[model samples]
Structure formats: C-alpha cells, structure tokens
Target: MLVMHTPPQHHIVILGAGFGGLRTALELEKRRARLKDFHVTLIDKRSEHVYTPLLYEVSTGALHDNQKFCVGELCSGVAVPLEAYPQAMRSKRLTFKRGEVTGIDPKKKEVHLKDGTRISYDDLVVALGSAVSTFGIPGVNEHALFMKCLADAFRVRQRLAEFLGAYVEGKEKRVEIVVGGAGPTGTETAAELGNFFDRLVKNGIIKRKDYEIRLVEAAPDILGIYPEKFRVHARARLETIGVILMTNTKILEVKKKQVVTDKGEINADVMIWSGGIRPLDVVKTFGLALDEKGWIPVEPSVLVKGQKDIWAIGDVAAFLDPKTGKRVPALAQATTKEASVVAENVTRRLERKRPMAFHPPSHWVTAIPLGGAYGLVDFGSWSLRGRLGYFVRKAADFFYFFSILPFGQAFRMWLKGTNVYIKND
Candidate 1:
C-alpha cells in the first residue's frame, strides 16, 4: 500500500516575505476561489516584512520613538507582522509559516527548513531577496555598518548614537562619518546625517565644523544612473550642507577608525557601507544555475529557465528588458510589479490559461531625499525638487503603506512614521 504525506500540503509554495513574496502571497489568496482545493504556503525566517525605503530614516534616528527610539516604532510600524495579513487570517487556502529555508531538492520538489521539516510542492516561487555585498573589501564585513534590514538599522542607530554622544560630551576630539558608496543609500545616509549634525549645532551641542561627512564612490559621478538634472541638484545640495563629495575615490579597505582608499586614508568615526546588494546564499541551495551576477535567469514571464515549475522574481531574478537587453534594476516598483506578474501567471497557469509576458517600465522614477527638508524626484519626463519633492517622496511611502495594510492600520503606521521622521526634515 502507498501512502501520501501531508504538507500542510500546498500546491504553490512562495519563498521569502519581502515585498515580492508577501504581495505574491496576498494576491494569490485573493484569487484563491479559482484554485479549488489547492493551497498556497508562504515561508520566511522573520516575522515582519521590512519596508526598506524608510530604513535610511531609521539609520539617521528618525524612526526613534523618543530618546529610546533605536528603531523601535519604525521596526514594528514600518514592518508589519507576517501574521497580520487579513487574507491569511480569513482563508484556509493561504498559510504563512515562519521558518528559515535551509536547502532545496529540486529533483524531489522539496524545501528543507532549518528545523529539519521538509515541504513538497508542485510549483515554487523563489523571491528570496538581496543582501548587502561587501565586494570582498578588507574589514568591511567586520568594521562597517550596513543598512540592509531592521537589525542593521538598529545597529547603525545605536553605534551612531554612541559615537555622536561621545562627541557631544566632549569625550571625542571630533566625529568623522564616512559613507562608502555613491548610490542612493550612501547619498541619502550622508545627506540625512548632515541635517542631524545641523540640528546638533542649532541646539548648541556641536560646532558647525565638529563633525564632517564624506561620501566616497568609485564611480566618476554621484547618482550615476539618475538624469543630469537630479544628479546636479543632489550634488549641489549635499555640498551646500557640508557633505564632501569624494567621487572616483575607490574604497580599498576599512579599518577600526579609518577607511583606506585609493586616493588616501580618511578618519572614520563611523563607516557606513552602502556599496551594493547580492542574492542570499539560500539561492544556491535550490540547485539552479544563476547568471554571472548570481541571480537566476528567468523567462520574460519569469519562469526560471530549464526548471519546469520554478518561478523567480525580485532581486533573485535576473529579469531582462526586451528593449535594452539589460536586467531591470532592483527598484521597489519593479519588485512589486514582479509580484503582480508572478501572482497572475501562477494563477492563470492553475486555471489552464497562458501566462503573460512582463513589460516593466522603461524609466523608473528616482527619489533622493537631499536632506531633512529637501528632496529630488526624477520622473524621467519632469522632476521636482526642494520641499515639494520631499512631500512627494513621503507621499510615496504612504501609498506603499496603504497598498499593503488595511486603512486604519496603514493610517496609524503612516502617522507614526511621519511624526517621527518629520523632525528629520
């Protein structure tokens, strides 16, 4: 006699709970009525889904609840619980399991969890997101601060607080904050730190020259991908606020109190590494071939190449643009859109309908918060700057919150974020 094992058996098992994964889970459940008896299981190690766009604020201490902030309210308010999904609560079809994926056996269609439990699936959606890439720079993994997740945000906040406090109390001669990387993360963190330092000056805590920030980038120019207009505006504003632009300066190594660069060594009371992101190691366990960048190659419809029922999306997927033949940048908009495409494709496949090809936007909007009160929003056709641009950026945050949360909860979360982060401006 043969016996079938129980899954909490699911037909579709989505991995990771980031924007791509969480949205995929909820959207699939919305169409649960079509799947008949088949169920969807979404698994992740963490309980909360981090909204990364606001993590810069967290690092700058804007998300602090009070003197005790330390990314408390923002972590909870910005990152909603996985169990908070209304669909998962109401439907038996959608299930959220909190577990870390250890390995995957593609031949058996099974996912092995950290706790030694195995889950078999007919179709698998891999949305495991990216991690900060040290790029093998010496001492970066040991001495530099990262801004990838909530825990990183908290570490940055606490470490900055300790260093800044030391400077304020006259225990340190001066503060030197070096942001390594000229990308959005590095630029934003440096610009926001300028505002925080200015506030300290206004409050008589530190002199104007007591603390300095240097933004180092190996690239020739900052915001290299943004249009000339946005880049010019951001560079100008950052300089006006005393953030030293060190473009074309390559970071060679990180020391305890200094950064060794191709140009010269610079003192670093705090070093923030916003260099880049890479796919997690878990992707390798799936027994799938990855592109040169360690991201899986997928069809235009996002089905993994050479894999029968495995689909890849978000940072883990090397989704290409038909026009440019370049992989889509791991922007938030593209990630969320990938969620919709994957959700629809999977549901349609289950319904015996053909999957649709994904056509992402030709130009992705770029939002750079220049400082506490100022921002630059580049819409490709036109752009906004100053207070208006900042408001637009904040509006995007609210829009994202509303998209994922119920109205009341979203409103409360938005209110909290706005209240805490407004002072950042």
Candidate 2:
C-alpha cells in the first residue's frame, strides 16, 4: 500500500538569523494570534545570534570575557517560539540537515541538504545576509582576518592578546597592526585596539612606543561615507590616539605577514580587512535576477525582480536609490527598516492587499566610537565631537541593541550594560 505524508499546516520558513531575519520572525509572531495561521521555522548555520554593530567592543575585551556565550544569549528570548534550527538554507523545503548548504532548486522550490533531508515551505523568506567580499583580491581570503561573526571577533581578540603577551615578554620585538579600509568597522576596530593598547601601557603591560598601529585606505581620506568635516574630525581623533593614517593607498596584495600596496609594503603581525562586503554566495544558487555584482536586484517594494513570492533585504538586496540612482549602502539601519517593510508586505500578500513602497529615509544618524570615551556623531547636517559625541554614540548603541528585545529584556540589558565592566572584572 502507498501512503502520502500530509504537510504541516500554516508553515512559514525564514532563512538566516541576522537582523532582518530575526526581526521578521518576531513581527510575524506579534501578528501570529491575529493571523492564526502559520508555523514559523527560523534557520541559521550557527545556533547563536550576534549584534554585529557592537562586535568590535567584544574584540577589545571591553564587553565580555566569554565571547561565545555573549552571542548565543542575545537571541535566547526570540528563539523560543521561532524554533531556531541550526541549519543552512539549501532550497525551498530542502535544507542541509547539519550546518552546510549543499544545493538548492529555485524552479521546483526544493532544497537538498548534505545529510539527505529535505524540507518544503508553504511560504519562504530569504534574508541570508551578506558575507565579507574579497573583491577577487588574491591572498586576502587566505591572509586577512575578518570581523563578521562572534568567532571572527574572538579570533581577532585572541590574536591581539597573544601579540600583546609576546610584546611584553620580548622587549626587542616590534609588533605592527595594520587595519585595511577605513570604513566604520575598520575605524571602530582601530579605535578599540588603540584603547586596548593604551590600557596595556597604563597597566605597564607594554610601553606606548612598543606598538605601531596603521590605518590604511584606498580612498582620499578615512570615513569616506561621512561628510568631509566629520572625516577630518575622525582622522584627527584617531591620530591623537597614535594611529598612523595612510590614505590614498591601494592594497595590491595581502601576504602572510605583510601587505603590498601601491605606496609600499608594510609588515604586520595582525592584519584586519574591513574593506567591503558582497552578497552571500547562496544568493547565486537561487537563480534570481541579480545586478552585475551578484546582488539581488529588487523593486522599490523590496521584491526581487522577476521572482514572485521572493524578497530580498539587507546587504544582499540592490534597490535603486530614487534620488542618486545608486545602490544604498548595506547599513544596519537600512536592513532593519527593510525588514519591517518585508514583514508588512508578506502580511499584505496573505491578505491580498497592495504592498507598501520602500522609501529610503531622508535623515540618518551615524555614531563612531574613536576609543574608550571618545567618538564622533553625524546627524546628516549637524555633527558632534569629543565627550558629547561619545555620550550620544553610547546611548545610540544601547538603544539600537536594547530596543530590539522585549521591554523587560531591554531593561535587563541596560542594567547589564551599566555593570558590564564590574561583572567582567
């Protein structure tokens, strides 16, 4: 006798557990009782979810001693009802049982996992996010360390700690730290390391003159995304903290212990590459309409062109800017806003209503922590510096991470933040 398995009723499958995916899942749950019709399945390769914006602090040892647990606990509240399955998105209903995404079929909407299990989804949401893009630069992937995840942050911290230990042990050893690209990640990492080195110096672990820190960028100046005045202020602040600024230098190659650039070669004990980001490789497997750079081309509504029932957000989605006619930068603010729109659109689709249009916000705020208790804040037209800027930056950071959680949970996080240094010590 032949038998057919009945599919589970009210299924909603969300791929990735990043900001976009997590937010979408939460919003769906918020409307779950009203909709009364969908089982949500949240899939990610890793069990832990991290707040990427504050990852640099983790690397500097300013956040937590145990970085592993910090990331896993960030999403503990949301993981309950969403069923956080540690799996990769291979296809529509098919996923790699373990942590690998082997194959996907967009046409038939089937995913094939490495362990030979398949899953079919009634409704699919892909928010797999982007990965560190090497930009076809040779030796980059093999040599330069990335700060994309908790593991990456931990690895960088471990390396930094080891380097410090070695420097303290051997007086003659000269350690050079090279940070490539002067974007927010690179800038923040440089600043945090500067503070860490300052702390080491103050603690007599190492002399201030023992370490050499270099911030390199191909652009004319650091903080290229921000206005020129803000860039000037940031550069000045970084220089004051002993970071050697090297602008207008293009990296030709990244060697095992050195970087070859248009200007010259610099030997480095630690190399961090925060140059740019590319779309996730899995996006290619979906066979969706993509731009020349492999980013999914989407309409104003954040829907993938030529692909119905599919949506893209975050760094992976390439939606044209109505004003500049250029692609928007893949910032956390952009991703979070896009997530809300995606969730609302999905709800509209279920109700057979028109989807809302995606509009880039007019004003955006960027807070960049220089080191320890100093930073720069840019509110489009206005900019703040020094202690005031630092206060705003810290407040913004707290708000951004805390607001994502429930009210009580947010309050707990606030309390934890207030006493994080004491507890860690």
Largest lDDT belongs to which candidate?
A: 1
> How well is each residue in 253-288 modelled by candidate 2, as lDDT tens digits?
999989999999999778999998887777787777
At residue 268, what lDDT does model 1 achieve?
93
Report per-prediction Cα RMSD to one decimal. 2.5, 4.9
Q: Which run of 10 residues does model 2 get worst, by summed lDDT?
A: 88-97
Score candidate 2 by lDDT: 0.71
Report how far off residue 329 is in candidate 1 (Å): 0.6
Candidate that would win on TM-score: 1
Cα RMSD for predicted model 2: 4.9
In order, candidate lDDTs are: 0.83, 0.71
TM-score of each: 0.94, 0.87
